[model samples]
Target chain A: MNKQPEKYQVFEKENEILRHSKDVLASPELLSAQAWQQEYERLAQSYAQLLGEVKLLTSVSDRLQNKLNKANENIARKNEELTQTLEMLTRERIGKRATTIVLILAAFFFIVSELVIDPQLQQSAKIFGASGLIVLKVTVAIALKPIEMILENLLLKTAVRKKMS
Target chain B: MENFFLEETSKTPKLSFDVSTGKFLMSGRSIPENSIEFYKPLFEWLDEYVKKPCPKTTFDIKLEYFNTSSSKCLVEIFRRLEKIKDAEIVINWFYEEDDEDMQESGEDFRELIDIPIVMHMIAN
Candidate 1:
């Protein structure tokens, strides 16, 4: 039954005014053109931000494409170099294989001729004279030794050169 | 002068120089193990030919590829041709249209040599 406080009354009146102001602000008739202008400005700023993002994405895409092209060119050049190198290596390997086969055949013939044919020839030459037989053997040994040494030296030189290269 | 003819190997080009026809052709790949041995006699022959230079000398170069050594030999051949006096030298450099490297190589040779070089781009 006591009288309400003055502070409470004043607070109630302030709340009522705030509520009325909010309603007025919400009303279309109370809204000024400046408010719409501000809203439009905000929307324009957001659009500008989105446009900037799109521009950045485009630039990034262009850079990526350029990098991809460079990578492709590098890969192609590497492939070409590899192919040429492989071809050269194969040619050299085949040449070496052929040379090895020839050398093996030559050695096989040399051994057969020296061990079997030369001894038989020397025995047949004994029918002529011991001097002739000894001379034939000496001649064959001298020729074969020099030839063998020469071949060995050539092979050694070739091997050394190959290793150095 | 005797004609120069060398059979082509897997890694070397065919070289045929006809003295009567004045036609010289070098075709195929060139990556010889001994470039000096392969090219020494060729240069000597060209040197001798320059003494009795023909009225028209046509060189047909249709190389698919070459290494650095072979490139040096090619330069030597071009220089030999450049030394000829009172002789018309015609060099036909043939390459595939899509071979950018060969095109650039032709351009490089053209810049290095002072001779009439015709670059022909053929489709492979």
Candidate 2:
């Protein structure tokens, strides 16, 4: 009868030993961490490659932006130059119109001097009148350039003042 | 199908799509003020070409410069070309040897489509 109880205790202890062995097998140590490490490394490599590709694309975009900026600067410079040239040409045109008007008025004066004033002059008057007429022609011819220059300079100053305002 | 030839202009490129040889060429600069209007005829011709495409079609692109709108149109053209099946489609991309941007642009297009693209560097 004492042998029977001892045998049952031994059997139950053997069963408990088997259950403990099963628990050991199911522990976290059986799982390989290296698999997760390898997957992490693979994802890291792909992330690096994507970063490099994005960097290259960003570099290309910056280069193109630099080229576009240079082109815009060139266009602005050319446009400014064209505007200045046009302004100068317009001033010169106005000066030329003034010259034409002055020339026409001088012609009228010459005609009046010749038709009315010249016939009324005596020999003495003729001498002085002729000299005065000659002087008038010379003055008109000499004043043409200075007049145009003055008019253009005035227009330029006015343009400058308007721009400043 | 009849051949399509458009002369190059200051704001456009030269396009010669020969139906007989199936050798399509687009050269020069493409920066038109009106992209849709300028490329309408080309799209029309491509529409007709897709209906009766050549057996072995090829595209040769040699451009010095192109704008954003032109690039989009070019992508659309490639998309249309992609629809053609059972025929070989080869695209040759030409660029200056010193032009890295053009080569990358070709690479970008290659990534976008399935057709084969070959880059040719023109020596100065």
Candidate 3:
């Protein structure tokens, strides 16, 4: 019975204190102060959330900048390589054209010597001794043979180089 | 002696040979698909010209590029020029200032062929 009464008394004391505080806050000024405190707490929470969002956005911006820089560097490197390749190709093309011109001239000379010069020499040789004519023809052939061989070797080398490249 | 003038094509060089004027110029690029076919008529003309040699035969070569096979043809041309005993042959080799390969090519031909050759370097 004593324990039950003590519990009842403590509950009554708490109720009284709550009623007194409510009566004190009945004034408009006091009520406004309470409302301001609640608003300040809400604002603080919102500020914290906004700060977190700003931090996330800053990190994302830094990552994007790094990616863009890497992409630019890669593009620059590729452009340099492409330029070098184009230069090399131009040189090779020029070399090939030069080689072709030389070969055409050689062929022309060979045709002339074989068709016209050889026949004239042969006809003259017939008037002279066969021995002299044969020697002359052989000498001319020998002289021309080296030139022909050199041209053939050069052509072969060019073809091989092109294939290798 | 007849005049042989072959117009320049995409694959061949320009050839202007005049028997009267004795101004034979072979210039531009030469990279023909069939070298023998392209040069046959030119060789025939040269053979005919050799019989009645010109007083002054000036061969101007300003080729930008040629192949190894073409080099042989050049040698043959040089030999023909060398054979003219009664005529004066003046071979002018023109190259670009920055082209070392062309300069060396001129030197090689000069060494191999016995002719009065003049080498001139021009700005490309």
Candidate 4:
């Protein structure tokens, strides 16, 4: 009386057939030729049925696995697309912040040049003149581009670090 | 016979076998931890149903997913239905349009079972 495996425990009909086969095997010479032929045919039919079941089950299982694999691939692709969109949004936000910071800095510099630097340049009108004031304002205007670039890079780095943490 | 209805859960499918209508439905996921235990009542109901089956026995199987054990239980269910000598039995197997795997599974069961299993696609 061989114990059925845990997975095959539910297959009571198949197990019964197996037990009958074992009984037949135990007394091989007792049965006549005609009886033996009948047993052989019965066993053959059972085997065919079991084979059909096995084939169907295997095919279904494989198909389900494939479906799960495809679903996983889709999720992975969607996750990647989401991450790219998020990064783009972060860059756009940082770009706007950088531009605003640069604008404010430019306003502060303009105010200082008018209130503080213009008076200081007045005393040195002999050597510097009004061209000195023009040069100062032009330098400040040219520096805004690099200032904005620096601020954007700094903000981007901070954002990246925050995300990593 | 009383109608047998089991609500669908995370691990098991909904089973609705109306004695009056003879329109049985087994839908949703079927990945129960104990497949045999989960399907025992259905099998018993089917056995009784076969003794005095309805004129038109329509079984609608709209499962999205089922494990191997559930599939075996399904085979048992089909075998029980085969015992009905008089009833006009039809199994309507439904699957999503993009779910070729599920469609192929329906075809596989159609080949194995003696009863007519009509495959229907649910538009994605």
Best by lDDT: 4
**What are the models' TM-scores?**
0.44, 0.48, 0.44, 0.88
Can you write out model 1's per-residue Cα lDDT over B2-108, one digit (the tens) per residue?
Answer: 89999988999999998878899999988787665688889889999988977899999998777655665676688689899898889999989876666667766
Candidate with maximal TM-score: 4
How large a fraction of the reference contact set does each model reproduce? 0.00, 0.00, 0.00, 0.53
lDDT of 2 by residue, A6-35 (tens): 223313323454454555456747547885
Off by over 4 Å in 3: A1-165
| The TM-score obtained for chain B of candidate 2 when compared with the true chain B | 0.96
| Candidate 4 similarity to native, TM-score | 0.88
Minimum summed lDDT over a 10-residue window in model 4 chain A is located at A1-10
Every candidate's DockQ is: 0.01, 0.04, 0.00, 0.65
lDDT of 3 at B81: 72
Give lDDT tens digits, candidate 4, residues A17-85: 989999998999999999999999999999998999999999988877887898899999999999999
Error of 1 at B89 (Å): 0.8
Candidate 4 chain B lDDT trough over 10 residues, lowest sum: B97-106
| Candidate 2 regions with alpha-carbon error over 4 angstroms | A1-35, A116-137, A151-165, B1-91, B96-100, B103-117, B122-124
The TM-score, computed over Cα atoms with residue i paired to residue i, of candidate 2 is: 0.48
**C-alpha RMSD of each candidate structure in angstroms:** 30.2, 19.5, 42.3, 2.4
The count of backbone overlaps in candidate 1 is 0
